[model samples]
Target: MAVVTRTEPPPRPPRRRRLLYRLRVLRHDPTAALGLILVVLLAYLVVAPLFAVLSDAFRLQYGDEVHAGQQPGEWTGYYLWRVFRSQISRLLFWEPLVNTLVVAVGTTLFALALGGGMAWLVTRTNVPGRRWLAGALVVPYMLPSWTFSLAWLTLFKNERAAGQAGFLQAQGIRTPDWLAYGPLPIVITLGLHYYPFVLLLVGNALRRIDVQLEDSARILGAPRRTVVRRIVIPLMLPALSSAVLLVVGRVLGTFGTPYVLGLPADYRVLSTGLFQSIRDRSTGVASVLATVIVIIGIVIVFTDMRLMREQRRFVTVGGKGAMDRVSDLRRWRWPACALGMAVFAVSVLVPVLTLLLSTVTRIPLNLSTFTLDFWIAEELPGAVGFPHGVLRGPELWEAAWNSLRIVGLASLICAVAGLLVGYVVVRGTAPRIAAFLRQVSFLPYLIPGIAFAAASLSLFAVARGPVPALYGTTFLLILVMAVTHLPYSSRSGIAAMMQLGREPEEAAQIAGASWWQRMRRIIFPIQKGALVTGIVLPFISGLKELSIVVMLTTTGTQLLTTLSIGLVDYGYTQLANGVVLMIALLSFTMTYLTQRLTRSSLASGLGG
Candidate 1:
């Protein structure tokens, strides 16, 4: 025994062996391995482009080399100085930043007010048309964000912005400059488009609230105001915060509406400024503006995270039996119904009707001028860019197919990758890896789409090792869309997976099933609804996306959105509106079909 002990137990496994053993253990854990890979990939994809943009901010870019008196690719602070301290800084940075804040804050408030009221009516009160209102109100979100802007212009546009006066202006209505463009129109358009985010989030939370809590407070002789203030509002804080964050984050990066409405009015927002810089080939300045936008976005996100931390302390759900109670509006039921319908009208019906009217008329809102030429004629004589009817051209069909193929592939990748990411984050053995996956997957959401597009254009325009130059390629478009839209799918996947217990998977493992088999048979079957939700939301979003595809798509790879914008550029208003209506219809039809087939609405998909 002494000799055996003196032999050091026949030499224990080396440190290398222990390390290898640990790696082997990780390899056996598919979740850990997949999570590590996802984290690494997302970090490279998300952080690398950001670094490239940041580097550009300090380097002498192509056009800036002459201005800065430095060679291209050399380090310099000329761009930052120009953006922050130069004579034009107010126009280039400060004013735009102020305008951005105004729009963001205004849109958030307007959306929250309208959306929160509707959510209360539908989820809490005995509103006469609750189901109809619930389904109809979200239609605006399915349409392009610019849909309302275009409608507003159609109704209120004066000679300032272009070709012809709008319907109201044409009728000798003096639409004020403030009403037609700038902050008011931008806020109202964006508010209508984004209010559904609030409705879905707040409505979902309201539905999940236990009636007993409010009832208990009421039984204790608490006033209605107190019950709402102390019980309802506290429970609603998380949803309200989430809704506000979503709306604000969107307002920060949204380019289409601001570009369309603000360009004519000289109303500049950060997104518009970034667009102008990129368009002018001022990469250095563009990077600086982009950096600022990213900083603001990060600040907003951090603030939201802090609020969410506080939200954790106010959990309302308990083990006790919970019932949903609807407040009887009595004489106010019909009025509540009217109010809900009015929201639907402003948010959905009006914009859609205007778009449709514009697409069918040579002069929008003029019945006598309406014609089918834009939609079905053999040729549109004197139409500069679109010489034929929108339906008669192969361009429309081909672009539609490309949009479907490219965005469809991207969405499929998003769904699968998101599910994998969720699994790793929720079930992985390594906590650090999980946390990293969670954060990196969400990184794209904070970067403005235009900035992200600029970054992609810069980074992917060159080849690095195994990855080829992806500029002007459909693959590049697919990749960018997938990465940018990954947040929706990943959030949906994580929510679904968190509700799933590990017992079923453990049972499968005990039965000698492989990791892939367990996931295929047990995990996927249970989370199919979530997978569809993830896929559908991105598909809808990508189909109507204008900002991302605008920068990345070339002539050969035009999407529906790019096509629509091109028509707009060529001043073919009806053709453009036709394309837009098609986009809205496609998005709405797909969303409706998904809901009918899967029994999952946007509310459910978003965990409302």
Candidate 2:
């Protein structure tokens, strides 16, 4: 037996040696190695910036040191005291927190009511033009979220805020404070922009529900209401909950709608408050507000996870023949169709028409005020940034090219990286590494875009170790855009990869193929559709993105979004509206062409 113990295999290798051995294992199976690399990279990109934000929250920031009676860079509790306990705490924190909750809750409720009804009508009822309605209703979401807010301001803006009176005021109608700006308009604007999320989610879930369950309940003499209350509602809870979480998350992080609508009424939400803090160079206060938003987002995500875990045992799908039975509305069919059309018109056509009308009219909503100066005039003497019409200026084309170059490249990187993350998560052998990569990549989605921008500014504003100062650089803009929009691409990748089998890669391996070779020759071809969807969605989103780019873009690196905001700042309303319309057209065209080329739909991407 040779002493029977064999000296325990030389006491095993040390921990370091074991790690090296694991690294060496990549020669045979590289998935774990790749997963670990992604985990580390994402941790640095996502978690490091957040750490910088948290550190700023506690440190004595510049300009704040004078107020706090502390030296800059010193540790202090002054920010906490000012934000939570001082006399202005209510104005700074409590009021904004309360308003944030009000807006978030209100928007969630309104969106649910509108979206749930539309989803039910489109997916469950025999509503005429269901096909068209389903496609048309999602167009609002495809546009920028703040488009509605801009349109609202165009129609109802009073002289309370700045610039000039809106169309209604110009027409001699007096718009009340509460109606013109505050929770009412903010809620409506957000609801219209975000309802498509609910519609898509609930509609998909509804389509998947086994109609046999309802049929059986009906055959058992259960009344329609009883069956709905007991079975249908319970089955739809998961989808509804998901939609609510999405709406709530969006509302929490939204800056443009609330800022545009809430400013005049002095209705400050958390995001706008954070924006003000940043703009005022109150880095400490901004950090604290950003931290609060991140915590709230974490709570929402955890709550959703808990609910999902509890509902894991409830299976809506079963081993039975299921069919989509369209409910016969007979006499109500035309009314239902009209209702669907009304939703589409309000959500899509109205805001767009409002903006279009504004761009052509010197005074919005005035037919006699129409002109083409904003679109094609060679020169405008008094214009600041745009001395010529928007289409005639080099600025518009430059910004558009920057947008296409920066966002296109970022989206491409995001798509490829997302697919790799999916591959590692689904096919990797190390469970912990896979889990870390998945979670860290999604961390950016939880943080508000403004907060992430703040973090990026803090982290990369100067050189840190190997990474040189990236502030005011195109690289920084691309990096932030890719990281912020990564969630969409990663989700699409994960869903697609989970459905893919390992057999193809295994066969390639049997033929002595390397990991890169297998991915290029086999996996890439299989997941190409998902790759395109991942890229296109982010491109559309980044094209209209304002919040993240607003903070990161400099004069030299201006994007379409920043240009539009600049025009608005300069009071060039018509030029601003023209740029926004261009963005909408670009986004819509890309979405349409991508769907046509790939034969995949936005619903599929979103539902996944």
Candidate 3:
């Protein structure tokens, strides 16, 4: 009847009908839009680079021109063949691959031994100094990998490659080649630095174990060791696997330790080899190496993920987990405490002390010879800006200020963007946007630090499109850092915002609170801790970072980490040590202050 009328209904309005359907779907499924958006963005960021890097790997190139023989932009397997299977692949890929596996396995074992024992001492035993041990155990994980690498070099560099006398030499000790450098030193250093990761994971798991399980096992006629083997070990497998994943990822992508300790001895792991290839402008080979690293990392991560995903329960019959009585070590308590302190002194304090001592000592990296003149004296004759005068020197201050400026700005950008990304992922009405935001947020996690830096360098090196000469800009550093740290920050923000819940915000909306007002009052205040962690974690991590910023800058924009690295290159071990110490101190200060504040806020938030 209506259609028969002169003003017939507008042609069924298909477009408007479809639009209305989508809106109805969105109303039915609000959070999914956000999830889809996050997933897409994350997929592009993580997977795009792999494709781009892979494409770069296959396409033949020499300077601006593609090679004459092959099709201009056609894909080829030349890179894979040349890097992985050629006669020279041994030097470029095979040996390095072997070295990486060896170091990784060795480090894994060492870390488990150290961390498991420490966990046992604190969790299951009346080990003296357990209170103090917990704090010290996490120190290594907190510091950057290279800090320990540099510390190892400062303490053990022999007269072979650099011929730089180290701390041992200063005390009239002739360290063997093995002690100074090689796979042994590399693995030990990496292990010591990473064991704390395992300690935390394993300790947390162990502490949460229900004592009643063991008691039940005992009641079932199971012996102590049997109870542990059948029950505890199985329970802890998930946490242990997670720890293994972390340490493996850490060692696999690391460039600094391998570079610092292995390179001088002609030892080439994947990172050092990849770095060398890039340095030689062998981008094809570097890409191949990076691809290899990525593949290995992905495999390990997926394995860990698969294991984690399949697990039904981390706890059995969850209760307020009982605290098991500590095993009395009898007379071994005091001695055990002493040993723990000694290890702490050497592992944590010694490296820091060495750096401070070296900074004061004029010889810098070559610590065998010492001079207070570097600290007290105004200037050295040939040194560019050195002697203790340089401590107060404008260049040093400028470098410090520049680092803070870039790092601060980068962290701020990351924090804000991360918060938005989190909110969108958690609260957006669009499914695609949600997935995209999540995927993009997780990209930096998959990329190796150096590779990511190189990626930035590659894309931005050429002045094209909207990017104008970002290759040397400090803004580039800020952008790169923010991007690199985005994955973690954004994740933290999302997790925080998720806990804010929909009810309160919904209530606010029904009460007619504006969007901004609801966000300012209800959402932000409730989830501030996670936001703080996002900011603080990135800021602290950026402070100790060298590998990312190293490939992206010149001496003019050198970071403290870069300076420590350069001091190594220049054979100024002591001054390098000082720079390292300063960086560590800065990190420690920030960590303590932020942790205190976080604790305070959480207490306040809960109390309120």
lDDT score for residue 425 of model 3: 76
Query: For model 3, what is the alpha-carbon lDDT of residue 342?
Result: 76
Best prediction by lDDT: 2
Any idea what lDDT model 2 has? 0.86
Residues 73-183 of candidate 1 have per-residue lDDT tens digits of: 899999999999999999999999999989999999999999999888888888886877887888888899888887888888887775556888778888888888899
lDDT of 2 by residue, 359-456 (tens): 88888879798888889999876786678888997899999999999999999999999999998899987888888878888888877787788888
Candidate 1 local lDDT, residue 464:
72
Q: lDDT of each model, Cα atoms only? A: 0.85, 0.86, 0.75
State each model's C-alpha RMSD to the native: 3.6, 3.6, 4.9
lDDT of 1: 0.85
Candidate 3 lDDT over residue span 438-512, tens digit each: 776776787777777766665566665654767778988998898889988888888887777799888887786
- 53 Cα displacement, candidate 2 (Å): 0.5
Which 10 consecutive residues of model 2 have the lowest summed lDDT? 599-608
Ranked by TM-score, top first = 2, 1, 3
